[model samples]
Target chain A: NAGVTQTPKFQVLKTGQSMTLQCAQDMNHNSMYWYRQDPGMGLRLIYYSASEGTTDKGEVPNGYNVSRSTTEDFPLRLLSAAPSQTSVYFCASSERLTVYGYTFGSGTRLTVV
Target chain B: DQQVKQNSPSLSVQEGRISILNCDYTNSMFDYFLWYKKYPAEGPTFLISISSIKDKNEDGRFTVFLNKSAKHLSLHIVPSQPGDSAVYFCAASDTMNYGGSQGNLIFGKGTKLSVKP
Candidate 1:
């Protein structure tokens, strides 16, 4: 079973370009999160949704936005990609609010030139 | 500022030896701490965790120790094997707020561990 799937595993975009990072999970989890991993910076939250139709900005949400229309799909959009946005993006989900931990996707490696 | 810090950027341990990775946090409200392991090109996976109420928690060969007063935590892997080589990340959350939901984990930069055979 595919726990979580992210599309465009690798991508290189010119500065000022726009792109969407797709995340889907088969676990039917209630919560979904978007995070970007940079050098010397762990996974910093970009955006998150506790449930469908409810999204919240995270620590670093300036250049990104997220929409969770369905429980299984949560997509992240970069309106104007910049070189500073180059980083590996990860998508994660948890079954509940417990400490069981989150199931993560393989991740999308994005590079803004 | 980094709320959670993994001071060691990397560590090397001989096979069959103990691998101890350390983490420190500045947030006093953080009560739940966890360790995650990640291989190249993959996402981090949960390894072990300890709550503020518990000083230590063990699962098989992996153990997590929490020192609340010191705001420190460590993950110990006994009899380290070659397969244990990877980047380890420390994450903590304040469960009191929103019941630990809303994606409240604050993570450290991570420490890459190498188990040499």
Candidate 2:
């Protein structure tokens, strides 16, 4: 089974352009997350959803937005892409919110020029 | 400040040798710790983990040792193989904080492990 899936494996955007990164899970997990991995910053959380219809900002959510209307989908939106926003984004899901590590998707490599 | 830190940026080891990746956390309140491995162009996957109550946990060739008092944890891969090469990340979460609904992980700068055959 595909535990977690992220669409748009690769993309290049210009500054001020907007886009969305899609994430879905077949495991029917309640908690989903969006994280970005940079060269030396590791994986920083951008947004998270504890359940369907709930979402919250994480450590690095300045230029991003997220919504969770259904249990299977949580999409991250970039209002205006910037050079600093260029990074590899990963989506993840977990069985529970209080414990357990996440199952991550392949990743979306984005470059903002 | 980064609560979690992986001092070494990268490590290299020969096949069949032991590979040790170290992680340290500044937040003493963190209870659950985890390790994740990521290949190039892929997302990081869960590797192994340890709780603050336990000092060690093992699964097959991988073992996670936690030193709560020292705020340090390490992942040891015995008889490392070429397939084991990847970027290893150290992550931690504090379940006791803010009702634990925010079970988000704080990750350290990963250490890329290269296993040569």
Candidate 3:
């Protein structure tokens, strides 16, 4: 099964450009998260969803938005993309709010020039 | 300020040796800890986890040791193989209450482990 899938494996955008990172999971998980990974900074949660139609901010949510419109899809939107947003993004899901059941996607590497 | 820290940026060891990755946390409230492994061009995958109630947990070649008193935890991979080389991240959560769910993990910078043949 495709546990978690993130599209647009790689992208480069100029400052002020906008883009959305897509995440889809077939595991029917009730929780999904978006995190950004930088060289010296580990994955920092940008946003998360507990279930469909619900979303919340995480540690670093600035300049990014998320929507959980369906049980299988959670997309992360980058508004006014800046060089500071250049990093590898990951999408993860779990059956519930637990650490043991976390499943991560392949990830999308985004570069804002 | 980073609540969780993996001071070591990278580590290298010969194959079949033991690989020890260290992590420290400043949050005493953190009750659950997890270790995730990530390779180039991939997302971090859950490797192992431990709760405050446990001192250690092991699965096959991987083992995690937790010292609550010190707020420190470590992951040990015995007989390290080349395939095990990756960036290891340490994450923790303190019974977060979020949208009727309890899973919000704070992560460390990560330590890159390289296993040489």
Give, for candidate 2 chain A, the lowest lDDT window spanning 10 residues. A94-103
What C-alpha lDDT does candidate 2 achieve relative to the native structure?
A: 0.91
Candidate 1, residues A49-79: lDDT per residue as tens digits? 8888988888899989889899999999999
* Prediction 3 global C-alpha lDDT: 0.91
lDDT of 2 by residue, B54-116 (tens): 999999999999999899999999989999999999999997772243556899999999999
The segments of candidate 1 whose C-alpha lies over 4 angstroms from its true place after superposition are A97-99, B99-103
State residue B15's C-alpha deviation in candidate 1, in Å: 0.3
Residue B22 CA displacement from its true place in model 3, Å = 0.3
Worst 10 residues of 1 chain A by lDDT: A92-101
Model 3 residue A55 lDDT score: 90
Candidate 3 per-residue lDDT over residues A1-113, each given as its tens digit: 67899999999999999999999999999999999988899988898888888898888899999999899999999989999999999999988766667899999999999
TM-scores for all candidates: the values are 0.97, 0.96, 0.96
Q: Which docking category, incorrect, acceptable, medium or high, applies to candidate 2?
A: medium
Instruction: Give model 3's docking category.
Output: medium
* Backbone-clash count (model 1): 0
Interface RMSD list for the candidates: 2.2, 2.4, 2.3
